[model samples]
Target: MSSLVKNIIRFILFIFFQHFVLDKISLHQMITPYVYFLFIIWLPFKMPRTWLMFIAFLLGFTLDSFRHQPGFHAAACVLIAYIKPFLVNMLIPQEGADTNYQEPSIKSMGGPLPYFIFIAVLCLLHNAWLFFLEAWQFGNIWYFLIKTILSTAISILLIFITELVFNRKQKFRTNTI
Candidate 1:
């Protein structure tokens, strides 16, 4: 399928996975792993930073509306979205950037090592912000730390599995995407 088609499907599937699956399964005192942020991470390498922020806001806002969490997720998503390009540059070193990849993957990004680190950082950031906000009123440092680590691990594992499963092999070459 085309990159556009794959991205649309990725967006929808992630929403369903987050809202219907992950959101519904509350871990209570434990951590709740979220894989939905993959949508933001999987966007084309050369996509505009501004557009990434917009889509991140939209994605988080939609999830917040569904879960009635107001601006919490939206805020975190925007933060991650804003830094995505910078992080990608640092981690992947886009001399050729493989723009048509459509999603961040080992096959497209050149190897599994850099891609894994990139995904891990984003997952940790998303989980840390989310759990920190959720635990704000309570003010439990341990919970925040534990939740971040646990949730990040789970989310990263899921991301790895998803990447392995789909394993798109196409690469899009462009200037500094």
Candidate 2:
């Protein structure tokens, strides 16, 4: 299947699973597992910045619509989408890199350590921005901090489990019109 088609399907499935399954499960008021961000993180390396942000916005907006929080998810998603390139560049060194790792995944990232770091950093960023925005105040800093940490850990674990279970290398073929 084409890359576009694969991504489209992934987008739908992630949103559906997040809203129906993940959102309903309340481990606590704080530690919510968010696998939806994985969709944005897994996007192709060569995707243009504008499109990436646009897609992130759409993904977050969809969740916002469902959850009744207007811009929290949208803003957080866009923030990570904006930072994704820099984070990938920082974690994946330029020396002797494999060009074929076109998307962010365990195989593409060389090993579990680097991939875990990448996911952890982004998950922390996402959870921090998201929970803070939801809180809308620094009055309870510790609350937000603990919430962010717990949520990030859960999200990272879920993401890794997802990667392991469906560990298929995606092949992207360019089409000529």
Candidate 3:
């Protein structure tokens, strides 16, 4: 149907999948692949920054409420939300950007390389903030680094897989009565 409808459904599905499936999978204490942030990352490019941040807050707060954490995800989500626009501008040059593309994706990003870079940087920042906040101490740098890196890698992998599986090439149709 419409893009708004699709995104609304996507938001629900991402929350359900993340909280039920992905969160339950514990490959290790240090590596939990969080693919939920993909929802925020995939939001329409034209969305206002304030609304983006608010939505990110809600997503993260919902997760925090589920997991019994105190704003770790919320903080990380806001961080990425705040930085996303700048990242988009930096990664996708105006001359090269496709105006028809509504959000960040491999196709919209022009290729796997730029998309990968975009995802990688955001995922890294997200994981780093999340793990650091969870730890709340710099007493163990290695612990933070290992956990952040592993989790970011797995999250990125899952995000890419999700994108490949679910990403659709949209078309606009005109109707005449």
Candidate 4:
């Protein structure tokens, strides 16, 4: 299947799962797991930055619609999307980066550490911005930090499990002309 088709399917599934399943699960007031961001994280490595931010905005806006929040998710999504390429470059490095990496899966990233760091950092940024926006008053910094940390941890776990379940190990190509 083409990357376009696969991404489209993933977009639909992520939205559906987030809205119908994850959003409904009230594990705690401060620990809502957000796996929808996984859709953005799973995008092809070379996708255009503009397209990445646009898609992230759309995904977040869609989730905001479900949650009845105005642009909160959109803001966080765009922020993380903006930082994703930088994180990828910093963690993976130019020499280690592969053009054929269709997605940021553990196998494609060559191991779990880089992939985990990539996802964990993005998740932290997303959750921190999200909770901060939700609590714009800045009433309690400690509470805000705790919420961000807990949510990020849960989100990271969900992302890792999803990658393990759905990501296939592809053989890396060595012959680069």
The number of the candidate with the highest TM-score is 4
Better of 2 and 4 by lDDT: 2
In model 4, pairs of residues that clash are none
Q: Write candidate 3's Cα lDDT for 100-170 as tens digits.
A: 57778887877899889999999999999988886775567788999999999999999888888885774
Error of 1 at 120 (Å): 0.8
* Model 1 misplacement above 4 A: 1-5, 99-102, 172-177
Residues 5-62, candidate 4: write the lDDT tens digits: 9889989999999989998899998798889988898788789999999999999998
Better of 1 and 4 by TM-score: 4
How far residue 169's Cα lies from its native spot in candidate 2, in Å, is 1.9
Task: Name the TM-score of candidate 4.
Answer: 0.92
> Which digits, one per residue and each the tens of the lDDT, describe model 2 over residues 67-171?
896898999999999999888878775543435656877767778888889999889999999989767655688889889999998999899899889877655
Cα lDDT tens digits, model 1, 62-158, are: 8899887688888889989998888777766556465545556776666878888888888888888888898897799998998899888889998
Local distance difference test scores for all models: 0.81, 0.87, 0.86, 0.85
> What's the TM for model 1?
0.88
lDDT comparison, 3 vs 4, better candidate: 3
The order of the candidates by TM-score, greatest first, is 4, 2, 3, 1
